[model samples]
Each structure stands twice: as structure tokens, then as C-alpha cells.
Target: MFTGLSAFPLTPVSGNAGIDEKAYGRLVHRLATTSVDSIGALGSTGSYAYLTREERARVARLAVEHADGVPVIVGIGALRTRHVLEAAEDAQNAGAAGVLLAPVSYQPLTDDDVFGLFEEVSAHLSVPLVIYDNPGTTHFTFTDELYTRLAHLPNVASVKIPGVPADPEAARARIEHLRRLLPATVTIGVSGDATAAKGLNAGCDAWYSVIGGTFPEPALALTRAAQAGQPERAERDSQRLQPLWDLFAQHGGSLRVVAAAAAHLGLTTPRNLPLPLRGLGAKEHAQVAAVIEKLQLHA
Candidate 1:
């Protein structure tokens, strides 16, 4: 199972309306130089849903190619089973370590339908799968029982559960149940720095981090703390991430925070957003820039 921080780099774009492969490689090169355990592109932060099928394939291919030895996992969130299989195939073809699977987006699907989609994915794809359970995007949350059933599927190697809760402790327990119930070969994961430390304490094997995509040094420090059983230091790092959380929640939607962080790091512009969604307005950019300035952390 993969552990520690994983970067979700912004998918770079050229001014002439094409993916800037050079910039994309530079981002991946930067991540490889960091201490992050892996780099996962094409997730929510990478604007996976906005990209066309070919564009998504290019992002996955480029991320893996530039990541060198670091495990590269590309998010595969498609409404159709055929599209899902195609994404998975593309990821394996690009040499990605695995695929991050999310259920059909926007439209609400039954829990059984979600599991069925993943089961179909498991049957055809040779690469290990990491379940992506981010309710903020799908508007559907999977329970421990449901997550376990999915994780136990053959070829399922890991799970990424975003820790979003009024009470971190309760969220931690449900995620832990997936880890405990699944076969030893399966890994349970969590993201959201606010609850990452708790997830690690609760027995999650990894942090499927977005912030790590921009600020790998600090994120890796937090993971190292957890690995060393240093709860005090981990807590300190978690507290430090509060500003990043505020940057997103203050405005709402998944892209703002990462985009803000990337802007702060001088890695990309705050105006850059993938398809289906546009860039942030000037006022919102000001707010994000102000908050990110306090963090004084850059790419």
C-alpha cells in the first residue's frame, strides 16, 4: 500500500489552448524532488471532469512520465463504464502506479450502482485501484461497509476517503473500519489536512493529499510525524493547514483552495481552471491570495 503525501499537481495549459507539456513536466519534476510518497493527477484538483477523454489521457501519461520513480496515480472519474475502462487502460499504458476511481459524477447513482461500476473496472483493469470518496464532488458518500466491499474487490489495492466531518473522531472510526475489514493487501486512505492526523491515528495507511501537490515539504513533514508516532508534531502541522482549508470553504467548491495554493507558490495563475469550470474572479482571487500570503509557503 502507498503511504504519506501525494501531490495533485495542476494540469498545465498553454496560451494557445493546449496542455503545456513542458510546464506539466516541470510540476512533476518539482514533486519528484520533494519527499512526497506519490503524485496523483487528474483528481478534482487537476480538473479531471472538465477534460476531454484524450486530454485526460495526456495528463495521466505526462504525470507518470515526469514523476520518475515516484508512484503516479491518475484519477479516473467517468459517467460511463466504457469511459472508465478506457481511462484505466490509459493510466496503465502511461506507466501509472494505479488508478483513482470515483463514481459517476453530478447525477446521483444508487450505492449498488457505484459498487457495480467499480467491480466492472476491477475485472478489466490490471492496475491496482484506489477508491476516491469525496462527497464534495460526487455528492455521495460511501459507508465503511460499502467501502470495504469495494476495497475487497480483486485488483483493489487502496482507498482514498476524504475526512470531512463535524467530528473528526467519528470520521476516523468509519475510515478505520474499512482498513480493519478489508483484506491485508488492501489499503485505506484519507485526505484533508484538518483530519489527516486523526486518520493516521485511526489506522489509515496513507494520506491522499491535494495540498501535498503544492507544498510537499510541509506535507511530508506531517506524514513523517505520523509514521514516527509523533502525534504532537503531526497536530502542529495539521493546525498549520487550517488556512488552506479556510481558503476553500470560505468560497466553496474543490478547485479554489488548490488553485489558490498554486498561485501562492508561483506554480500557476489563480485564473487557471480546467474545463467545465472557469477561473476565479478578481475579488475571490484577492481573498485567496491574502490567505495564502499568511502561509508564506510556495511551490
Candidate 2:
């Protein structure tokens, strides 16, 4: 479940309405039909932080149901350890193959605090747990020492690190260093879609992707190429999507651009993000459409 492309699908919610289960199921089913190794139901890209517990549980169940036989890894992050435990229980009940936990908090969390959270959660989880080190959203940076500590916890299967360095050798060195620190039982997955190919080439075990949630084909193509030791093909496939990566940088991050792309493809309703968040405007949508067309992403 931790290896290859773990596609994190958006949890589409219309304005002043509940989750669009039909649309969400469509996204999960689409991924299951593809070569994605796992379905990441409610990661950062899925807007798990914004939904209620009931809503999140429903989304987890939906993801598992729609995923066919593909493994489903559900995000179970919350502000409090109690709530995180509750979310973990809900995900387990929903038959999630694994749970992804990010240390989310309003107040800054110390390494001990973060480790305690994982320790408590890991003790309770029957399935594997992926340590989500998404500092971009959680605002808690994890050190190699912290990773070593957390990796020692039982049921902790993988660590989703941030992007690797742009330079190839530097990226490989970074990954190699982490590999030595982490137990062989624990895998190191890479986030940051733009650098996924490089990370894989650097020997990272998986791509915890944002764009893969919406466009599995290209992401899977890159993943398969990399895993097959065809680094040149993987890099070329990644370079081909540079325009979309630029769009992610132009916008705040991947969440908005991917939502816009999904809407453009008619895979989900326009403005499908949760309340207090809005989709791209007309001009930006036009740009997304152009990029999708040019890349032949929908073909």
C-alpha cells in the first residue's frame, strides 16, 4: 500500500451542501481502474481537515467501496489526540487498509508532543499507519531524529517526506541518508508532485501525489517508468508536466489547481471545494483548461 503511486483524491463538497458522494466515488473508481498502487482517500488534497468526523468516515467508506480491490489509505488527522484516535477508529471500521496521520495543530507542537500523538495512535491501529510529514499544512517540521523515533513505533509503515532537492545527486544523497536512519521495515514515500520522478529516481519507495488524484495515467506512467529503472523516461514524463507544476506554483498550491482541473474535466462540479475556499476564477480556469488540453491529460 505504501509503494508506487498513492493517489489522494479530492473530497468534493459543494457550497452549503454535504459531500458530493457521487463525484467522490467517481474519482475513487477512476483511480481503481488505473495502475495506482493505492487510493489515498482523505489526505491534504482531499481537504480532510475541513470535514466533520461523520463526513470523513463516510468518505473513507466510499473510497474503500469504490476502490475495487485497490488498497485504500485514509487520512485520519485532527487537532486533538482524542479526535485523531476517533478518526482512526472510524477509518478502521470503514475497512481502510492503512491510515495517514499528520500532526495538525494551531499551537506549535514539540517533537515529543508529535511523537506522543503517533505513539498513542499507532498502539490503537490494527492496520498500518503512514506518518504524514506535510509541514506545508501542519506547520510542524519533522527532523531525521524524530523520523527515526517514529519509525521505531509498531505499525508505523512509511514516512511521507517533503520534496527532494532539485539536483539529482543531492536528492539521492538525502534519500540515502533517510534510508539509513529509518528501519528497513519502514518505507520513505515522497510528496510534492513536481519532484516525484526525481524522488523515485533517488530511491524513494512511493509518490504520495496530488495530481495523481485527478490524472492517474500520467502519474502512473511516471511511476512505472521509474520503478522499471527507466529514469530517463520517468524524468521526461515529469518534465512534460512542467506547465501544470508551474500552475501549482502560480496558484497557492496544488489543491486549487487540481480542483480546477477536475472541474474542467467534468469529473466534479465547479467550485467543489469546501466553504471558505473558492475555485479558480474564469481566467485561471481558462489557463487550466489550456494546459490540460495541451498536455492531452483528458485524452
Candidate 3:
């Protein structure tokens, strides 16, 4: 359903309670004006697990309404198959181009259990389904065998791999392994924001990105260079983003960093995430500002 950079905006909740609808409109508008191939609503960066179903549905509607023709992909992952089906229905009704599905789990899942989840969802989905293989969050890893099987399922369009091994040689080899097994039409998306540029160079078709969702221009620069085989330029720009990436690594990853950076840039209101997951403090906020300003990305 997509290729190139698919930017996942942090779901901005207004200070009072629910999603900041106006702020979300502005966020989607900002990304739609860029070279991004798609805008993903409720991806991990969007805090999908924290929001209520009503909020998730509302976010999907607002994202599609303001995306200005850029395809809006909603993260519709839920622990139960029935819940996922309901969210998929919401996404389709809201006019999202596709729905991102992950195998959310409390109890461990067997391969048949995981495959059956997609099978059930796909049977009811009219829109394309992006298989989110984020073991870090979902705790369910897709073996190559499983991915091969899922890739053959109806409505399955892409697979978002959350990690590409850090070693360049191993990373490329892993990409090749997936390429060898997956259906030719299925796009391989790389999602580790810290190493996205390298992943792009390693042959991932799309960057299912975190940092790029907040600061797309620089991310696109890196993606373009790598896609065009200009590794040196890609590396240079990726290096420029190292400071910001460091903050993500240090401060509970992209969910916190993007929310903090978005507020710092005045792109969204100052808001805390759902409880037990606090926003960045003053010290970390200062670090974000310094890095954004240093890279001249506050533009």
C-alpha cells in the first residue's frame, strides 16, 4: 500500500483530557506538505496502546481529514482479534488508506495463534494491512517462516521490521533474507529511527519512522540520498541527527522524545502521556532544544 518515508506523528492529547484535535490537524498538515509518502496515525509514536478506542477512532478521522490527500495509515493493533476487527472497521470508515496491525499479547502466542489473528482480521478488512513486527513492544516476533506465510495472506501489503542488526554486513544480510522469503509485492519497512538511514541503505523500501515523523525534511534528505545510492550524503545527514537520536536512546525512546520535541518546537501543546509514562523533564527538554537548534531543525 506504501513505500518511501511513512511518517508516524505523535498523537497529541490536549492538556484537559482527550486528543488535541486542532493540534492533530496541524501535525498532519505539517507532514502532508512534505515529501512524505504517507502519514501513519496511532503508530507506536502515536501512543496507540494508551488511547481509548474512541480517541483512536477520532485521531484516525482527524488525520485523514487533514492529510491533504496523503494516505493516512492507522495503527489498529489490539490484544484481542475482535477488538482489532472493530478498529479495522473504524479505520476503513474513517477513510484511512491502510491499517497497521501488530500481534499485541499478554500471554505468549504460538505461531498458529499469531497467524490466526491476521487471518481473522484480513477476512474482514477491505483496506490493506501493514503487519507490524515490533517485538520490542508486542513481544511477539515473526520468524521468517511466519512472515512468508503472512505475506501470502490476503490484504497483507507490508511488514514493518523494528530492528535491523547494527552490523552493516549483518543488516544487509538480514534484509536479503527477508527479500528472499517475502512476496515481491510486499514492501519491507525499517522502523528503528536511530539506524533508519543505514536500514534504508540496506534496502528497506520504507522508513516506518519515529524521528522522521516529527522532523521530516532531514529524514527525507537522508532517505533520498540512500535510495539514490549516495551513501556518503546519507551518512553525513544521519550523523547530523545523531544528537537527537542519542536523546531518543537515553530518554525512554521516541515516544517521549518526539512528544518533548514537538512541544519544544511549538508544534503541539505541552501535555503528559497517560500515567506511568511521564513527559520529559526540564533537563531533558533542554537537551532536546540544544540538539534541535544545533542541527538547525527547529525550522
- Judging by TM-score against the true structure, name the best candidate: 2
Better of 1 and 3 by TM-score: 3
Worst 10 residues of 3 by lDDT: 269-278
lDDT values, one for every candidate: 0.77, 0.95, 0.87
Tens-digit lDDT track for model 3 on 123-191? Answer: 898989999988878888888899999999999999999778878888899999999999998999999
User: Candidate 3: how many backbone clashes?
Assistant: 0
- Candidate 1 regions exceeding 4 Å error are 14-16, 164-172
TM-score of 1: 0.92
TM-score of each: 0.92, 0.99, 0.96
Give each prediction's root-mean-square deviation over alpha carbons: 2.1, 0.7, 1.3
TM-score of structure candidate 3: 0.96
List candidate 2 segments past 4 Å from native: none
